[model samples]
Target: MDNTFARCEDLVFSYDDESRDVLCDVSLSFKRGEFTAVLGHNGCGKSTFAKHLNAILLPCGGSVYVDGIDTKDEERLYDIRQRVGMVFQNPDNQIVATIVEEDVAFALENLGVPPEEIRERVDEALKSVGMYKYRMHSPHQLSGGQKQRVAIAGIIAMRPECIVLDEPTAMLDPIGRREVLKTVKRLNREYGITIILITHYMEEAAMCGRVIVMDKGKVLLDDVPKEVFSKVELLKSVGLDVPQVTELVYELNKYGLGLDQHIITEEECTEALIKLLS
Candidate 1:
């Protein structure tokens, strides 16, 4: 049984006829419950490619499918969006209601879901993101991370099977970034929601199960994080970086230290160094 939750096939898109293609022959599939990170420099078409997952942007030359439904099927637009929700870079743009709980319930209310069910979902979503205590609090009063969590709660309340986050932590500080990332990872690990995270932060990508590197509107690399980060020189050539620890290991390997080139985490790098010294 194939487990593809979303897919793009030979996708080719451009802003207009005069402009260059933003995505060229981009074909990839997201598995049902995998945590995948997309990495690329600015203007590398990572964000544009993400929009294709949910029909936000249509392919001029190929197709995008979610749960086997083609995104171009206007009749299934609602179905596609419900299955694959989007969380953009700015949380402020997504939060609609003044109250945290109300913001979470906004989508359900719009869909005309029952009041009782709405209440249940609102509470559940907020609690999932660790923000139930602030349910009645004003969203404007919360910190950046809190607001982003609330925004995410809003999407989860709608019960999306997958989430496409386009640089969700870009505007956040380190603490805020950590808070959002933790919530995202938990949702994928605990609830089995497929995650497609488009980010430039090497550290953030390192935490994901799979990493895809994009350049010039095409996929340059796709593999497990350790495998993808192993190509430090190639990534650097395309204006991308591996995790800091991966880079350190790569540099040490250059000096014949015989460290692992695929070390992507601090713990692994530390262990490798300790073993070498011992």
Candidate 2:
């Protein structure tokens, strides 16, 4: 059975005709329930490409298909967006309502969903993101991570099959970053929601099942995190970094320590080091 959820076919996009193409000949498919990470330096078109997934930005010369519906189809725009939700870098910008639960129900209310259903969905979404206790509180009272979770809850209330998050943790502190990442992982792992996370954090990318490295509006690499990060030189050439454990392993291998270059996690690196010592 074909499990493809969304796909971009020969996608070409640009801000304007005068500007260079931000996404050039980009073609990829996101399978159902897959957790994928997109990595790139600044202005590499990762965000531009993400916008196409939900019809926020139409392709200049090609097509973006969400569940077989063309994003260019004006009539199905709402359908496309409902299937694929987007979360951006700053949580403050995504939050609209002052109250947490109210914000989650905002979209549903606008869609004219039934009041009873909206209430049920809002509660479920808040609980899913572990922010149920803060539902009655004002969004401003919550921390950065909490705000982001509220943002995510708003999306979840819509029951999206896929989520495209563009650098969702960029403004968060180390602790906040961990909190958001944990919530994202649980969403993908437990709910079976397909995740497309755009981030510059190599460690966060390493946590994903798949990693796609983009440069100059093209995909430089796409594979499992271990295989993709193993090419440290190629990734570095594109101004991208590998996970810290992978970087350590790469340096050790260069010094003839013969460490495994594919070790992306600290636990894997520790095991390899212990074996080397033994």
Candidate 3:
């Protein structure tokens, strides 16, 4: 069988030694070049699961493999980390160097990449995220969105096969959110990078190829955005709200409007409503 990019097989995890498992026998697979969104409420183990992808957290039971390399193997730790780069929520916490280019160069430096190669990779990464012009700027002086892009550039410099973002935009405002999301989507669509995004934002989740909804540490739903959002009751039960447009369509259907069940975008909803009226 061809090796998957990432796989969690019967995985179980818990921070407390004696507490119940935070992730209970959870199993999932992510192929290379796929964009996957993981959604769930707080304490639902979504972040914990993200940590496992890069071997930041080891499974209490079962296993997590990145490109068929077992995460439990200490010898493969560095290899797994280089293969799956992570970006966390807080931009402040992620920035290591004062200068934008220096921050982007940090990870590559640690990996002992040659100085000449580091400069090339850092420049490419900054350009990839549209932050090359800010390479000399101090990270503290940049706007929230710009800073977040620098953080993403830092990860990109590592040249990971997959990037796992854990609530990467949660700390940003609307503009920042859009900027980060657009950058991430472009990376997935254009560069063929596997992206596993863990977020609560319905709109961001909608942009992914597949959505996995978790509740009480287990996956309750795993399907395409349209199919997952169609389950209004199930999503609500897990404390998740569908995209506003999807909810509007669901409510319209309830009142005998008979709109297309797959209407997810605002434009689609508007067109469906017009057809219903006509």
Candidate 4:
């Protein structure tokens, strides 16, 4: 009956005694197969939260649990990490193997999976991310997005039930960003993998079903994307942006044109305006 795939109970973390908490009373939970976006300005402890997902950082107070396995339990550490894989910001930093397929197979190899199974899973992972054609090529030759996909493939081959990405698109150009984002979305939809994406891009956050906004180590908003992003003034006050389409609708409303303030995309904005005109 327990549907929560991840949970943080009154989580608190601090670097040192004199330093204030980087995360304070951060209690939250995510359902299995849900795609959730975590958004905040720089130094808001978003990354710090991501690290706690896979036990990269332990809570100084309270506790974090992955599938009911507490992260504070030393024995469950590996089990927790295997259940929730992490993909960091930089693809270059993650790619260990020179060749694409080799990189994809890296994690499986580390886990002592059979060589034949590794090959099969590696191929599937690479193809799932749309990088199978470059399987034999060196990762250094691939574009930023392709490399990021490869990094994801490596995680996919591990068959983790969830992925926690910390600004995976931050280092990519527009095209690369699109590729990585699309890939992650597909992974969530087609594979039923839980996704926790940390991003500053309002557009990217708009794509998620749920959004969590944090500031100064505390969660400020937790709701569906529409409700979370509709608070234009509050989001701005905390140094975050609403989606462009939401902003456009807000401006139109300010000028006395009634429009749906929750529109998250240009297509939705156009539809609302058309309906308003009719």
Worst 10 residues of 1 by lDDT: 14-23
* Candidate 2 lDDT, 154-187, residue by residue in tens: 9999999999999999999998899889999999
Winner by lDDT between candidate 4 and candidate 3: 4
Question: What's the TM-score of every candidate structure?
Answer: 0.98, 0.98, 0.97, 0.97
Cα-based lDDT at residue 168, candidate 1: 93
lDDT of each: 0.92, 0.92, 0.91, 0.92
Cα deviation at 189, candidate 2, in Å, is 1.5
C-alpha displacement of 68 in model 1, angstroms?
Answer: 0.4
- Pairs of residues clashing in candidate 3: none
Model 1, 197: alpha-carbon shift in Å? 0.7
- Residues 1-278 of candidate 3 have per-residue lDDT tens digits of 77479998999998876587899999999999999999999999899999999998999999998998999999989999898999998999989898889999998888899999999999999999999999999999998888889988998898888999999989899999999999999999888899999998998998889999998889999999999998988899879999999999888889886777776788888888788778
Q: Write down the worst ten-residue block by lDDT for model 3.
A: 257-266
Compare candidates 2 and 3 on lDDT and give the better one: 2
lDDT of 3 at 205: 93
Count clashing pairs, candidate 2: 0
TM-score of 1: 0.98
Scanning candidate 2 in windows of ten residues, the lowest lDDT window is: 13-22
